[model samples]
Structure formats: structure tokens, C-alpha cells
Target: MSIEIKMPALSPTMEEGTLAKWLVKEGDTVKAGDLMAEIETDKATMEFEAVDEGVIAKIVVAEGTDGVKVGTVIAVLAGEGEDAGSVSAPKAESPKAEAPKAEAAPAPVAAPAPAPAAAPKADGDRIKASPLARRIAAEKGVDLSGVRGSGPNGRIVKADVADAKPGAAPAPKAAEAPAATAASAPAAAPALVWYDESIPHEVEKLSNIRKTIARRLTEAKQTIPHIYLTVDIQLDALLKLRGQLNKSLEARGVKLSVNDMLIKALAVALTQVPKCNVTFAGDQLVKYSRADISVAVSTPTGLITPIIRDAANIGLASISTQMKALADRAKEGKLQPHEYQGGTASISNMGMFGIKQFDAVINPPQAMILAVGAGEKRPYIVDDALGVATVMSATGSFDHRAVDGADGAELMKVFKALVESPMGLLA
Candidate 1:
């Protein structure tokens, strides 16, 4: 029997991906661990590798195909003694595709299933599924037990859950409402939007990364009650410290950016004010002992936050080196899921762009995000006397549900002190 090669979930949350390119074509001989294709997920473009040695019989899914659901066969491999031309691809559909269709179904790009297939079957006592698939199932309210597995060894993948409908709910009481009220209910019509087409303009489709950014940002602003706090900090001490550190480490070839130091400062501040380092769940509050800082890096696709794990415990040199590597990979869309995933808090620096002050929206779950502004020479108080000094403005955006205004202010106070004192971050 020919072996089927399906689209793999490149990330924990990946449901569908674009087959950006294929490295191997039909008639090519491949061994385990050989690069087969490049898949573009919402966050990055990752290479898929072959797991079984065989002759490439056919490429089922063509390259440049976008929204290819996970577990959908993309290629076929003809084992030894099998005729390559005789090897046929498996029917490219999941069992849940047979479910009753709603009046309006979800968009194909969001969750595309193949042509009609068999009805979903139970997986007995154990339901096998990828982590990504399980998460997607929960979000869609789909029960995994009812979905049939299309993966190897009858494993459930993302495509299975994407095609499955949510489990049935208990019917409402007939006496609770008028029959006419229930029967006549209709969805509200969508509002019409107008654009000025008279002016010459070109429309471009949004990349997956851009689309995710739009959705997540909208959700963040809509769900999180944000409290903004601003403070002006003196940067003279930090600048001097950075110069000294750079001179000492010049032979090591490790140069630290101001953002690197700020990351350390923010981490240290979080540790000092533990109340601000938390994630707000609906029913509970999660407190983090270690400060994992997600530093915002802008890429060609969109903004991504590559994490510096345990920033409070690591040295400045390590932080600088790791951050540089992470930032470079982030721009190239080469960062892995773990590199950009969980963090206790975040920091975004717009200083390089000459932005003096702007409040940043909080990344969800995380209680707070520190926004750094440009440092400039300004009149300041020196030993109670007016003088000129390098000053910076920073704002902290906090989730009010998790962190109180006083706690947020305390974090800002500590961060300001660390930046002004400069030596506290080193400790």
C-alpha cells in the first residue's frame, strides 16, 4: 500500500497553512528526515520533513495552495515493489464533512474540509489528537470523541475538528418563550461599507500573520480593560552604564542595545512588584514567579514578540545575545512557537522611530506591557536644581482586572528607578 503524506501542524495553534513551496517532486527518491516542503502558518514558514523512505509517486496538493487543512494528504509515497503511477492518493476528506450543514457555514479559508466523506465515528475509550487540534476543538465547542481520525494509526488532527460541528446542547423549554418570537428571529443585516473608488488604489490580500494580528488586537482591546500609566525617567545613568558595559565587552563581540537593557529593567521591576506579573483568567488569577519578557519585534509580516525566558535570572550579555538571535529569526519568520509563546509580561520600544510617547495596547492574558519612548535631552531637576539631562518617557498598559492601578504605578516606579539607577538591573 502507498503511504500518504498529510499536512502537519507546524505550530500548536495551526489549523490550516499555505503550502508555500515544495522541495521534492514526483519521481524523486526520498529518505527519512529529508526536506519535503515549506508550510507557511499564521506566524512562520516552517519546513516539513519526510518520515518514511519511498519514491515520490505524486504531489496531491500543489505548492502555493493556501488554506490547506491539516491532515489533508498533500503527497503520496510509493514503497518498494509498488508502481509509482499505480499509487493513488487517499480520498482527501475528513469524516465530519458529512454532518448537517447550517444555514450559513464558516468561511472555507478558516476551516476548509475536502469533498463529502463518511460520517464521523467514535474513537472508543481513547481519542487521539494533536495538541493544536484539541485546542481548536475546544474553541469551536466541538466534541473530539465524535470526530473521526484521518491521521496515521487513526489519529485525529486539526482538519477533523475543523470539519466537525459543536456537540448538541439541551433544548430550551417550550414554555420559556412564545413560539412566534422563536420562529421569526432572524440575523441582523450587515451594515454597508462604502469606499472612494474614484481615486486610483490597489488592493492587497492580507497575509495570515496580518490577519491574526488584526483579530488578536481587536480581541485584546475589546475584552481587556486597560489602564495606562506614564512616567518620565532619567536615562543619563543607563546610557553611561551601557557605554561602560560595551567597552568592557568589546573584546567578546557582544554589543547590547538599549532595548536589551530595558528588557532587563522591566524584568527586574516585575520581580520587585510581583502583583503586576500576572495573567487574568475569568475565574482565577495566575501569578508568575519568574519574569519572562516578551520583547516586541517588528517583522515584514507584522509585529511578533520573541520571549527572553527568565530575564530576571539571566545576565545582560546573555539577554543581549539571545535577544539579537531571536529578533533576527523573528524578522525572517523562522521563530518556533515556544520562542514567541508564553510570557508573564511584555515590552515594546518605539524609541528608534523617534516616538516620544504613545500608549501600547496590552497583549491578552498578560497583565501589563511596558512601552518605551525615545530619550532626548531635556531640562530636568538635578539635586533639586534645574538642569539639562537625557530624559525618557515610558507608559505601562495594565489589565485592570488583574493588576490594580496602584500596583501598576508601583511597577512603573520600580522600572523608572532601575533605569535611572542603572546598576539595579545588573544585580
Candidate 2:
């Protein structure tokens, strides 16, 4: 019997996907759990695996096809010596939560251009151009044998085209110029010259993930009035504590990062300022009993925030392990929907990237997000005496509808104390 293979729903929010590429070909044998196709969602490109072993029969959907609704049949799988006419599946309906299904068989592509025959020697026979240059000359309709090379032994380079006599049909006007003195540099970053008329561009339809992100962020910004609060934490103690912890944990092959400590501190501090932990729920406040913190990670396709559930209950050691796992999965685009969605709060740390300070957009349903910056040694007043201390700046973006100025400040107070003291996180 033949089996119809449809596009799998990689995430809860995925409604449609672009067929990026197919991995298998028609008439090829496939095994269960074999990689078949790569689908490009709004956020990432994920691989689809075959569920049933069979011989490839047909491919209905071609690659580069967009707006392909989920459950759309892209291919068919059949057993050896079996006719494929009996297979039937609802292609219009949503995909079932079945085991992995479908793999893309590699399809045929356009043939490559043939290599050019070798030109007679140019050493004394006048400079002969390469096949690529000859092809380019043909495309641009330029005579190659007539051009002389400025290169060693008279080998023609693109520069020879520009150096051609100006009156000679405008020597490759489209050719780019080589670098010159700094003064001749094209305005560092070139400034756009204004046009008298505007040119129209084709608009692309938004993908499912992009549409969801836009709608959620727009709603959060419009419905939820945001309040910003900034604070600087003296991290001398925190730095010392992290160094000590790393020394002890180094033997165990576990390394703790400063962000891990902050995650733990934020989780513990959320309990002290419960208001910040609550989400806006219609007319009432929906408070979470445990702190589920989402850490923002940048991926090739888009940004993905993976959650560390009940972070407050976990120690720094556990948080480090979970973060590494989450980062690896995120890069591979293999994370499940639940692994990234539904967090009460989020933390975005650009400290590693040397970002001094920046504000973050609050992810909806979550009332607040904390942006952390790099720690730097700076002059500070310590007990009425001027001293240099390592300090890092952080800013909290809170939903004004759920948290007020005083509430936001109080929440920062807890964050400041926890981060500055550092050792209190263990307590």
C-alpha cells in the first residue's frame, strides 16, 4: 500500500511552511526515522523524518512552494511491487499528532554550464583570457582577444577592462573598481542618493511564526503600557563568588556562568516581589507559583526564547546544564513548542557580546523582561570613600497595567540586593 506523506507541524504555532528542500528521490528506498525534507518555518528550518519504511513513489509538492498549508501532501511512499493508487489521506485537514512522517527525496536541478576550451597560449600569442572572463566578455558583448593584460606576463584581470581606452565603448561600465587611497573610499558607508521617483517593491506574505510574533508584540505594546526602571549592581562580591564556585566545580566538568547566577537570583527574587511575577488576565491578575524564566537566544532564522522551568527551585549547577542543552537544541532548530513558549518572565543577557546597555521588548503574557549589560571596573563611592568597583547595569521593562512605578522599583531593589550580595542566592 502507498502512504501519503504530508508536511509535519513542527511547532504549535506553525500553520504553514515553505518547502526548503527534499532529501530523497522517487523510486529510492527509505527507512523509518530517516531524514526526508527540510521545512522552513517562520523561526527556523527543521528537518522532517520518515515514519514508515517504503519505496518512494511520487512528490506532489515542489520545493520553493510557499503558503503550503499544514497537512498538505508533499509526497507518497509505496512498498516494492505495490501499486500506489490505494493510498488516501485528507490533505486539507490539519496534520495528525502521529509519529514523524515524510522525507524529501532529492529532486533534479538545472544542469551546469560546460567548461570553456583552453585558449592558445598568451605568453607571446597576446594575452588570452580565462573561460569565465571569456563568458563574461560574451555576456557583456566585449571582445576579449583585443584587450591587453596589466597583470604579470600580460595576464588580463578585470582591471584591464577598466583601463581600456575610454572611447572604446565604455570599458565594462558595470565592473567594480578596486580599492584606492582612504580619501578615494566611497564615503565609508555609501550614502543613498535620492531619486525623483519612487520604485515599488513586491510585498511578501508573512509566515505563521512571523505573523504571530508581530501580533503578540503589537498587542503587548498597545495594550500593555510599559514602565522602564534602570539599576546598577556592584558585582565585586558576585565575581568573587563565581570564581570560587568555578574552582570547585572545574574538577566535575561543570562551569557556572554569571548569567546562571542571575537566573537563580531572579527566580528567588520573584518570590519576594510576587506582583512582578503575575501576568495580566482579563480583569484579574494571574500569578504563577513557580518562576519559569525564558532566556532569549538568537538563531539563524529568528529569535527563540527557551524556558527554564522552575528556575528558582534549581541550583546554579542545574541551570548551567539546562542552558547548554537548550542552546544546542536551539541552534539545531530541534526545540519543541513547549520548550520555548509560556514563560512568566524573560532574561536577555548581552553581557557576553559586550553590550553596555539596551532595553528589551516585553514578551506577552509575561509582565517583565530584564536586559543585562557587561560588568566594567569603574570608580564608585564605597562607604563614603571613592573606590573602583566592578559594576553592571540592568534595566527592567514591566507592563504598567500590571506593575506600577513603585512596584517596578521594589522589584529592582530585590534584584540589586541579590546580584550585589551574590552569595545570598545559595541561601
Candidate 3:
């Protein structure tokens, strides 16, 4: 028997990926855990590993193929004692392929038999459900028994569990009938408007990463109610501290950037104002116990946020080292899913680019993002007298649904105090 090797889902949100490269070719012997291919997901390019030892019988999908869906067979492996040459690759059917004539009705008879074979088990055994479906049911407190299976062989799937109501009686078959009919009905296609080719322009296809970024940012702006709060903080104290820290750390080969200090300041502020470190769950507010800040990095493909896990607990030297590495890998598209996934809040600094002040879109599941601008000399009122001060404008974009205006203001106050004091971040 031959084992089919399918494209693996590298991230939870990954539905399709580019088959970037293949490390193994047909007739190549591979052991379990061996690297077989490089798959480029929306966030990063990850190495795919083999699970079973076998000889590569055939490569069904070639490298550089884009939009290869998850769970699609990419290759076939011949098991031990099986001849690699004898193993046949599955044929990829196209709409242009010739279809079977009416005389081939006998072939359809066997297909109907498999459908019945997948029917619900007898003897009142446990329901047949996908792992994802079971996990969703457990999380949603939905009873599996009450949920109807719409998958092949009457198996419960993720969609079925998602639509199932917890504690409520299963929908009557008559009620489900209309839904099934609606689902089966073909949706009308919208009219297509062709672009004018006479105009001089370039048509560049969007990469998977770019497309994902566009969709996610669009959703964030549309769904998350944004509340923007801006504060002007004196950066002289932070600058002096950074200079001294960098001098002392230079012996250790660690140079701290101003952004590193901002990261620490944001983390400390989150701890001081814990209420601001929260996310909006449908019916509940999820408050994080620790401050993990995602720092935005720009790559050739698009923007990515790589997290600094427990930024508050880590020292300035450690933050500098880790952030440098994370940013480097993020730009190279080598970051793992975990490195760029979850965070209590985020920091997107455009200070380096001389952006004075700008509001950033809130990354979903994260309630807030701090946008940092460049520090420049400005007239300040000190002791009721006008004076010069190096100040920077910091804007906090909070999800109005999760954080109150007072809490957001308090978070900003704490952040400004930490930066102005310059010693609390070290403490």
C-alpha cells in the first residue's frame, strides 16, 4: 500500500499555502521526522516533516505551486516492501477532462455503496465526529449527540458543531430541510466589470501574505470600534537612560534601541493598568495575567507582528537581543506561527520613519496598540514658563468594545510616566 502525503496546515488560519520547495524527490528514501518540503504560509515559510518512513513514489504537486489547499495530496510514498516504480500517482482531474459517457453508469453504483458504508454506526455507539468538531463542541458546551452530522457517512464536522445550539433541543428535521435546500442551491454570481486595458498600468498579483493582511486589516477596521487617545511625553529622560544603558551594555555586545525602551515601557504600563490589558470575547472580557507585546515589523511581503513573550519580566538586554532576532527573522519570513500569533497588546513604532503621530488599526483579539512617533524639539510649558523639551506623541488605539476611555487614558498616563521617569522600566 502507498501512503498519501498531503499539504500540512502550518498555522491555525492557514487554509492554503505555496509549495515553495521540495527537499525530497521521487525514489528518495525518507525516515520519519525527515524534512520533506518547505511550505510558505501567509506568515512564514516553514519546513514540512515526514511522519512515516518510505520511498517517495511520486510527487503529485510540483514545487512553486501557489494556493495548494490544505489536505490536498502533494505526494505519494511507497511503504516498505512496496515497489516505488509500481506505485501509481493519483491523477489530478480538470474541468476540461473528458467525462464518462452514460454507458459508464455501472461505475456510479460502487460510489453509492461507499456512501452507505459511511453511515452512522449501529449499537448506539459514540457519534463519529472530526477532532476539530469534537474540540469545538467541548469549548462551546454543545452536546455532540444533539448535533446532526452533515459530513460524509453521517459524521459530525466543524460546521455542524458551530451551528449547533448548546442546551437546546436539536433542530427538527423539517427545519433542517430548508437549510439544506438553501445550502445546495447555487448562489447567483455578481456581474463582472472588466478593467480598461487602454490605460497604462501594471497588474501585479497579490501574494498570499498581502491578501491575508488586507482581509485581516479590513476586518479589524470594520469590526473593532477604535478609540484613539494621544499623549505627548517628554523623551529627554528616556533618551538619556537609553544612552547610558547602551554604553554599559556595549561591553556585552548588546545595543539597545529607543524602540526597545518603548517596548519595556508599554509592558510596564500594561502591568500598572491591568484593566487595559484585556480582549473582548463574545460575552466576556479576557484579561491577560502577563504582558506580551507584539512589535510590528515590515517585510517585503507585508506587515507582521512578532511577539515578545513576557516583556515586563525580561531585562533590557534580553529584550534588545530577542527583538533584534525576531525582527530579522520576521523580515526574512522565517518566523514560526507561535512567534507571530498571540499577544495581550501591540506596539507599532513609526518613529524611525519620522511619522509624527498616526493611529493604527487594532489587531483582533488584542484590545490595544501603541503607535510611537519621532521625538523632536518642541516648546513646552515648564513651571508656568515656556521652555524647550524633546517630546514625542504616542497614540493608543483601543478597542472601544473592550476598554473604557478612562482605562485607556490611565494606561497612557502610566506609559508616559514610565518613559518620563526612565527608571521604573529597569525596576
Candidate 4:
């Protein structure tokens, strides 16, 4: 017997990916948990592991193949006692076979649909669901035990889990609606335009990372209602405190950046104003108990946010040390999916680039993101008199649907206070 190995979904949102490289050849023998290939998803390149021990029989999809759909057969493996050389590759349907049918029947025949309410048991013990469905269920806190399957062999699919209501009765199989048909009318195509080729230029294709970024940011702007709030805070105190702390901690090899202190401040602010530390689900609001701050780091590929778990609880030195290591790894594209996946809120600092005051887009699921700008010398009022101070602008972008304006303002106030006071973050 031979086993067909299909392309695996590396992330929840991944529909297709590039098969970057294959580590094993046709004659190579592999054991369970052996590295087989490198798959490049929209976010990062990850290694794929073998789940069953066998000898590689054939490679259906070659390396460097882009946009290979998930669950498509990528390779074949010969089972125990099976001859690898004798295993035949799966045959693809030929267009000639369908030509006769097209002439006989003008209308095309639709493929047979799977049952709408088949509850396939996995290994005759556990419920079987797609990886995406499982992830969605976990995030939405929906009890999969109570959900019915509507996929082939009673396997649960994404649509089944998405339509499952949390804490509600399982929808009756008879009540399941038929899948909607495609529109009879075709969408109008946009006008084609071309640039003059006489002007010397080169065209570069968009990378997977760039494409994903464009799609996500466009969706974020169009779907998520954004509310921007800005506040100016005196950074003289924070700068002074950072200098003192760095001098004192020099022997310990821990030097903190202003961003490190800002991370702590934002985390503490979230705890103070807990309303801002939440995610907006379709029908539910998920409030987190701890502040896991996702700090945006720019790499050659694009921008990635690596999270610092329990930022409010960690010391400044630890935050600095951990952030440095995470940023380094992120630049090299070595971060694991879990490291950049989830956070209660996010922070994006552009102060290093001397960006004075700019708004940032809110990362979806998170209720808010704080954008930190450069600290510059400016005239300020001290005790109702004229004074020169180092000031910076901090802008907070909130999801209007999840966080109220007042709550967002309160969180910003607390953040500004902590940054100005400086001792609260250390304590």
C-alpha cells in the first residue's frame, strides 16, 4: 500500500503556499517526525514534518512551486513491504474525457456535494475537524463537542464551526441551508491600462509577505472602524530616568531603551484601564487578564510583531533583554508562529525614524494600538511659566466597536502619566 502526502496548512489563514524546498528525495527513507520540506506561507517559511514512516515513492509537486493549494497531493510514500519503484503516481483527469460529456450535455454537471450533517468520528473516538475549524473554535471558545459535522465522512469543516453558535443548541441537520449558488451575472472587468514601455523601468513581483500585508491592511482599514486619539507628554523625566537606570544597570549588562519603558507603561495602562485590553469577536468581547504587548519590528521582508508575554509583570531589564532577542530573531525570519501570533494589544514606535506625529492602523482582533513618535525639545509651561521640555506625541488607535472613546482616552491618560512619572514603570 502507498500513502498520499498532501500539502499541510501551516497557519490558520493559509490557503496556499510556496513549496520552498524538499529535504528528502524519491529514494530517501523517512521516519515519523522527520523534516520533509520547507513551506513558505504568507507570514514566514516553516519546516514540514512527516507524520508516518515510509520510503519516498514519488514527488508530485516540485520545489519552488508557488500557490500550491492546501490538501493537494504533493508526494507519495510507500508503506511497509511495498516497493517504492512500483508505486504509480496518481493520475490527473484528462480534458479529452470531458470533451464528449460537454457535447452530449450542454449544461455542465455539478460535482456531488458532501453530506451536510455527517459527524465523522476520528479514530472512532475523537471528533474530526479541519485545522482551521479547530483554531476558530478555540479562539471563539465554542464547544466543538456539541457541534455537528457537515463534511465528507462526518468530518467537521470551517463553515460548520463558523455557523455553530456558542452556548446555543446545535442546529438541526434539516435546518441547514443549501450552499448559495454563484451569481448568474458576471462581474464587470476594469478598464485595462498600460504604461509606456519607452521609459526604461523594471517590474518586480510582489512577495507573499507583501501581498498578505496589502490584503490585511486594506481589510483592516475598510472593515474595522478606527478612532484616533493623540496626546503630548513631557519626556524629560523619562529620559532622565532611563539614563540613571542604564548607568546603574551597566554592570548587569542590561541597557533599556525608551521603547522598553514605553512597553511597560502601555502594559500597566492596559491593566489600569482593562476595557482597552480586549478583542472584538463577531458576537463576543474577549477581555484578557494579562497584557501581552505585540511590538512591531521592521524587517527586510516587511513588518512583524513579536509579542512580549505578561509585559506588565516583567521587569524593565527582562523586557529589554527579551525584546532585543526577539527583534533579532524576527529580523532573520526565525520567529515561530506562536511568537508573533496573538496579543491583547499592540505598540508601533516610529520615533527612531524621527516621525513626529502619525496615526497607525489598528491590528484586527486587538482593541487598540499605541503609536509612539520622536521625543524632541519644545517650549512647555512649567508651574504656569514658560519652560523648555523634551516632548513626544503618543497616538492611540482604537477599534470603535470594541472600546469606547472615554475608555481609550483613559488608557492614553494612564500611559502618558506613567511615562512622565517614570517611577511607576520601574516599580
Clashing pairs in 2: 23-104, 23-106, 24-104, 24-105, 24-106, 25-105, 36-103, 36-104, 37-104
Order candidates by TM-score, high to low.
1, 3, 4, 2
Give the per-residue lDDT of model 3 (tens digit) for 1-427. Answer: 8999998999998998888789999999999999999898887778899999999999876676666789878899999999999998765442113223322332444353332222222112436665556655655557677778775346576668776776642443673444323322221111122676579986454667887889999999999999999999999989999999999989999999999999999999999899999999999999999999999999988899999999999999999999999999888778999999999999999988989999999988899999999998999976689999999999999999999999999999999999999898898
Candidate 1: residue 306 lDDT (0-100)? 93
TM agreement with the true structure for every prediction: 0.77, 0.70, 0.74, 0.72
**Ranking 2 against 3 by TM-score, winner:** 3
What lDDT would each prediction earn against the true structure? 0.81, 0.73, 0.82, 0.81
After superposing candidate 1 on the true structure, give the runs of residues whose Cα lies further than 4 Å from its correct spot: 93-194
Using TM-score as the measure, name the better of candidate 1 and candidate 3. Answer: 1
- Residue 17, model 2: Cα distance from true site in angstroms: 1.7
The best candidate by TM-score is 1
For model 1 the local lDDT of residue 204 reads: 51
Off by over 4 Å in 2: 83-215
lDDT of 3: 0.82
lDDT of 2: 0.73
Please say which candidate is ahead in TM-score: 1 or 2: 1
